[model samples]
Target: MLKLVVNNDLHVNKKDTITCKNSCDLFDEITGECSINQGVDIDSPYEAARCGFFIHRDSMSVPEIKDHTHFKFSLMDDIDDDLLDDQEIFHQLVGKSIYKEEYTYPLKPDFSSYRDDAKWFVSPCGSYGCWIVNHYKKPLSIPKSKDVAERGWNNRVYKSPIPLHDHQSALPISSKMAWLIDEDGFGQYALLVNGKISSISAPKPINWKRH
Candidate 1:
């Protein structure tokens, strides 16, 4: 429903990969290597947008690092199975896994609405779900396949599962969703105190030590 611009402002593209060139400085967010030696077409800007926006939590509550919870975030179908029946390119939770070895928090706090502000969301496969926000910010990583040892950022699991309210859209939040805006306007991560995001950066790196 949200129209996010995939501003690859740098116009960054490796041999065949469109990567997060901007964020790599924070860490190598882009792949150092590619599956094919030749270049791959960047997901169409429209497709990219539908494939969803790279959700960056501009604000959130503190997480209870000590607690470990089982979140059903990986299964796109269970989240909206009817939509996934065609199985275009959406992820399937049936064979996927959740990341816990590092204790990531993708499942909690789908949004950081202080009271009701919501962020525009698209499933990695492009499904849109109802707005949500919990009291705190917990980074839970959703993984494909239940292999505990394989739970890490790499290995095609970095994309968090998108939650659709209904109707199956596996590669983009269909335009249909935006038209159904509920009373709340559903989402807007930009908190307007005077109309701007709070602009706070992570104070420090946290090691949850979650077993």
Candidate 2:
């Protein structure tokens, strides 16, 4: 079953509350007001990401528009319950929500090989430096909740859902793609380049929109 929690200006439930020190410019510190026109309800982390909400790093709660507390959480009866079983869905949500810089063409087209060429593309992981993907490294811990709306980011490379493929990730092509690689490295929903898989990484944070 899908679970939901609603929050508003008058009452903020601990389960649905989102807090950050300097996250949103739209929030009014004195009045506790959120100036955005966020909808009353968001059903999934995927949907929340599309709306530019982000998972707070410290709280590990469902991402929300800070100060835009008038929100209602509900399950979409039409969504397949089986799809919710995939923990990869949470990983996708984190990848989608975080802001990252992307390049259409290879950063260095003259690299000796596709593997070397792929390394030129970098993820501006917030204030951190380049995200290093090591094939031999273990995946970082992330929220294991099956509830899509409750998932949060864990400040690490998003692990691939498929076993033995932890270093790679998949995200939807939001705006562009310009080169082809001969490697299959992404999960489903990734934009294929010449029938090969591409790596995915989370970007920096995005601010909530103001009305």
Candidate 3:
């Protein structure tokens, strides 16, 4: 019963409904030309994701974080949303050992342990970038809220101290712009510039929490 807050909406472990402009709708595999520039409808996110196009919100722009303290982190469970606006503020209260004593914050979470389900070459065809979804080896029992109507971004920033490509399990798509699908099968997107992954954005969800 793993729950994920993708694109600011809570989603269950099972496949959910989704619709977006897929590469198949725009790019002609045989012709390799832009056939249809508009969005194509799909009933499932996994189905749309397999086609290699995931919505990136309202814009294709990826904002740069000048300061590490300003990093926007994901706060699951019962946490104040205001703290997400300021990383330094979040660290002061939430990052303290007293708050996360029971939690295990590994040095670097294994991003590759998850199984790759699909990949896509992102472009202006969709929400500005492409994405891939990976499922974890096992399901997790994550918590969720009754009201799933919170509309916003819930992305966590994980800056690798060293280059990910240099690692033994270096992802082949390290040089490409793609979303980091979490164990729940939904996560955020990161920008790989000069082989380095920088600021990451939120991913699209099949359902948006409505007020």
Candidate 4:
């Protein structure tokens, strides 16, 4: 299963027990019986209660890369209408001009192609951006860890390439900010200025190898 490490502290195994915030039925449909606080398993109950949950996409299943041109991109924190309606804040964070690029799959990809494995960058609009690499490639491998205690799924794994010390200034006004580095340190996934996770599936199981 996918292993998620946050700030090099919290570790969670990706499993059915994990829950999502924006993707939850209650958050989306309002009338749905589903609740956001159900079935969550974080190591620390205090952190779990405060951190809540987030949906981390694992794959992209569009018929063709061309079809993804208009895919919506937004920050996970902007799910509420009250937050999204802040046009001034959105523009300040995402900017105005943006670019787009098409990518052909590097390796033959199955129908379950994922974007995290491909080369792409976020746009200024905080929506979709350009694909710097081939789009046809399959998604990157899930991160793994030797420590069982650190071998769990987590939503924070969706955040990677985090802002460095110099980039901290952008954090306050930034519209998007999320990055995840697999346990193996081979792959990376980042959120758009808006907050969309690159993939569709939840974190996958990590393939741990005994030393």
Best by TM-score: 3
lDDT of 1 by residue, 1-211 (tens): 9998786667656433433222111111233311111132233333222222222122122111221122111211224546446342121112111122332122232222223434444445432332333222434344453343222222221122322223221211121121111121211111111111221111112442212
The candidate with the higher lDDT, 2 or 4, is 4
Assess the local accuracy of residue 137 in candidate 3 as a C-alpha lDDT between 0 and 100: 44
lDDT of 1 at 90: 22
Candidate 2 residue pairs that clash:
99-203, 99-204, 100-203
Residue 50 lDDT (model 3): 50
Candidate 4 or 3, higher TM-score: 3
Q: What lDDT does each candidate get? A: 0.25, 0.28, 0.33, 0.30
- Model 2, poorest ten-residue lDDT window? 180-189
Model 4, 33: alpha-carbon shift in Å?
Answer: 11
Better structure of 1 and 3 per TM-score: 3
Q: Give the local distance difference test score of model 4.
A: 0.30
| TM-score, per-candidate, Cα-based | 0.19, 0.18, 0.21, 0.19
Compared with the true structure, what per-residue lDDT tens digits does model 2 show for residues 62-150? Answer: 33223212222222234355645644343332222222364332232221121332232332222111212223234433234223212
Model 2: residues with Cα > 4 Å off, grouped in runs: 1-17, 21-52, 55-77, 90-211
